[model samples]
Target: MRPNARFTDVQPIGLDAVAAAAGTDPDVLRLENLDTDVPPPPAAVAATTQALASGEGNSWLPLTGLPVLCEAVAGELRSRTGLDYDPSRQVVITSGGTSAVMPVLLATTEPGETVALTDPTYAGLLQRVRLSGARPHFLPLRVEGGHWRLDRDALTQVTTAAALLLMSPSMPSGVLLDRDDWAAVAETCARTGAYLIYDAAMERLVYDGHPRINPCQVEGLAERTITIGSVSKEYRMIGWRIGWIAGPVDLMDRIRMAVIYNTTVSSGFAQLGAAAALTDPSGSGVDEAAAEYQRRHDTVIDQLAGLPVVRAAGGWSCLVNATALGLTAPELSSRLLRYGRVAATPMTAWGGTIAPDYVRLVYSREPVERLSDLRYRFDTALTSG
Candidate 1:
């Protein structure tokens, strides 16, 4: 039997193709990216090595998760979010954050139901919602005071009997939802009985001295809001593919069932490594990476400020309005690779009705020293064109 082909319509990530076309080498800086340059913490490394040596991690963990890791995650949540979450009940460790969401969508929405998101949001969620046989409803975010804000009333009007998936410190723009915004969204979800799927993927990479807030902390939202996150960003363990879904036990039970077919279980040794990151995250690799990202963010911002075409905020990416150079985002992106030798992702692929003129330049992957090269080449391209 042929598998569903809905995925074919979903384009592969532009960054990978762009990087390939740009011909990345050790000497060239790669800024169009996510994840970190640093490795996972030593504790995780040591524990994984120990687990492998003892042959302890060879067995598959339970569908729900390894009990110890689940408990550790629970403790981490209480410490970080100040919300008392029962690990044994509320946590289901999936392969990663992406795995966590699929089951949540299946459990919460029926075919043809809507999954709403802010405009120009994360691309992955858009593809996931479509894959689940749901329509995507977009609420275009208006920029005010150099930050993106949701129109609550507009969102309520467009979406009913749907699930809203949102990322805090959102991708591309990196706008962290304020307390008031969170309250408004929570209230909307409650009134409408819409399941809230909070993707805390980019929340930890926050800048401008903002505190991270989980949507589950909203009053009466613990039962309704499902949070999907990973050890990728903060733990710098993107390769480990460890992530989770935390919410109501009953809801998580359904997610656990859907997880049975998708790789069945994550790597046992990797889970051990992930547990160490969760339990002893402070001295872990996150601090150094966070500092490096902060510096890179600053460097990218400074470099883009010199460019007539690029503007950015929050995350380690700059969205350049490239239409003035007489090219669509993809065309400009192609040109930047062939001519300027800079790789960037066009914003059009991210879904919604974002301007086709804009391209997202990921600054995180490039080292601080190499940033000047990308800037010089990129700016010169704009000038010469």
Candidate 2:
């Protein structure tokens, strides 16, 4: 191991293991990953197909990304944040949202520097911070009033951080950050001089009339924020592997260098599809998909109503309190997979104190029809195992 490496505390999220164990068992519901059965925009698919057939943009050139895709990303950011981004100067396409994250961390922080992240945040992100040689400082998300919330007191803790990774409709917990949360975030960042790396993978994937304040919308955060977005969630284009980073021109050069060196750009052909997905309003299907995901989220809550599952205000997964069952999350995960036919992932080192006490049930992957049997499965898993 390299002396500078910092991934010793990082544990696998258990999705791959659970998924591999699930194998060809069609009966096993695949809730272990962030996926959707919903199709991508037809225009995106068509564009990708055309790009592949034409063999256009098959070179290692254009290290940033396709012009159209970058412009589309800038436009999207502008519409949501009301902050204009110069496509050429302030944007760089990435392999995916996850890929974009590490580069931002690398660009913004030095080894042993602190990077604030939410406890119960994506394990991938926590591990990425570790991989980049940064200390992961978690802002605990307290379960309050049937929803997940960041601890206001904990926001003051991150004032020493070099970067703060934030996501609305935060993964696993599905907690949408409100106005107060954004305000607290602004205060923390302003005090710390930390870069706000906002993950927009599921920005628009909110539900039940909850509002998400774009980080850039917070006073002083527009220039302080670096937004990372991808087609994986909102546009339902996971396979395309295209993501973008948008920030101020001053900080963007280092981020762009990190982007180029990190993954050397997303697939050239896939960029065309992502551009199509971003530009084609009618076919993006974001709002419609959010509605369906909300239905699925509600269904999961209903199915596991009596269980200690936390309500997901928005996003893909629901956190089931494994501690209530007198078992660790990994133990519950195994039993659920074996007996319940559910492939929920155990929150091992995902982050925070409550992490290991819970397992995640990703609602986006399965349809409501398949999830109707969730209660029975949980019953069997709980009783038998």
Candidate 3:
């Protein structure tokens, strides 16, 4: 039997391929992943262990999520965005941020509808839209004076689109959409009667003292926006596989149904751990982690100075213009893996026709001390070429 036609041409460039090219584990100073070197918070670990021992997490939970976890997520959302949501109705705990996307897409849009996305977006999102039998329309971002800005005019042109998937403090480019950007998107969505799917996987990692902004907080957009968040990046709990989706109650009901028909439910113990992580009295180590990432960001940008690299305003990764080094992103990535033993992801995998000349380097994987080594590797790779 043949697989689905949507997946026929979807060959993702994953970290394993990069690791193979480097002939080493992807974890070894390999900057291909956003994984941090830090361990999980003590509270999260203890909560999960306690849950497993008490047998509270051994069985399936409600498809919407456990009550405690839902409340924890709702409360966190209220604290962050000044938006109140009913724990029982507006929030659904998901397996991960990636897992949350498909259900939302399936629940909101019909087959063959156009789903808009920023060019150079997360590749996984592009595939998910296709898997849902929806078409994708990319709105290319413009780089001006080192900042990546949204093309509002282009977005407004797509008046017939059904939904828009946005990652603020977006991946790879790491450009955080400012308030005006959010307003433009909200206006466009409102005008077109389109939904806004906000992927906030890296929401809390903003650097250079910039405050985090949520599009849902904008006037009139709350009811039309579905916000997806996870503890993976902020709390350093990537392995937990816990995340959440929050939206208007009526739409959330459909999403809950989708979750039931999809994964059924997320891991109970992982939800417990995630709840503890979100509600931890000690602030969950998020601030310290954000500070650490900011340091890594500054260090990496400084080390890669003189290269055609745009400084990342937020998020864990930044884009390097590989053309300056006389190589395409994939070519530069392969050469870097072979000579420098550094595994950087080519932008071809991240999607968009505009990304061919760029490579994405994740600084979150290596510690501050190892940054010097990363710098040296870059020097050798570029000079020797």
Give the candidate number with the greatest TM-score.
Answer: 2
lDDT string for model 1 (1-385, tens) is 6877656546565767767765745544565677556677888888889989998868776866788788878887776678887888788788888777778888889988988887777677777888888878886766665456666666658547678888876777565687777887877787788888988766666676777777777786667888887887777788888888787777777877777666588778888888998888465856567667777777766776644333333455656666656678887776776567676777776767763557776766677887766667776656664
Give each model's clash number. Answer: 1, 0, 0
State the lDDT of candidate 2 residue by residue for 1-385, as single tens digits. 4554464776776789888898978899889988789888999999999999999768786898988889999899888998888999999999988899988888899999999989898988889998888898888988887778889898986658898998888887888888878888889988989889999889888888878568788887887899989999989999999889888788889989988887886798999988988899684899999999999999999998878889987888889999998998999999998899999898887887878789999978799999999999999999993
Model 1 poorest 10 in a row by lDDT: 306-315
TM-score for all predictions?
A: 0.91, 0.97, 0.95
lDDT of 3 by residue, 240-319 (tens): 99989999988999998887888888899999999999899998888788888889888888888787888888888888
- Say what the RMSD of model 2 is: 1.3
Tell me each candidate's RMSD, in Å, in order.
2.5, 1.3, 1.7
Ranking by TM-score: 2, 3, 1
lDDT of 1: 0.73
| Model 2 TM-score relative to the real fold | 0.97
lDDT of each: 0.73, 0.88, 0.84
In the predicted model 2, the residue pairs found to clash are: none
**lDDT of candidate 2 at residue 122, scale 0 to 100:** 90
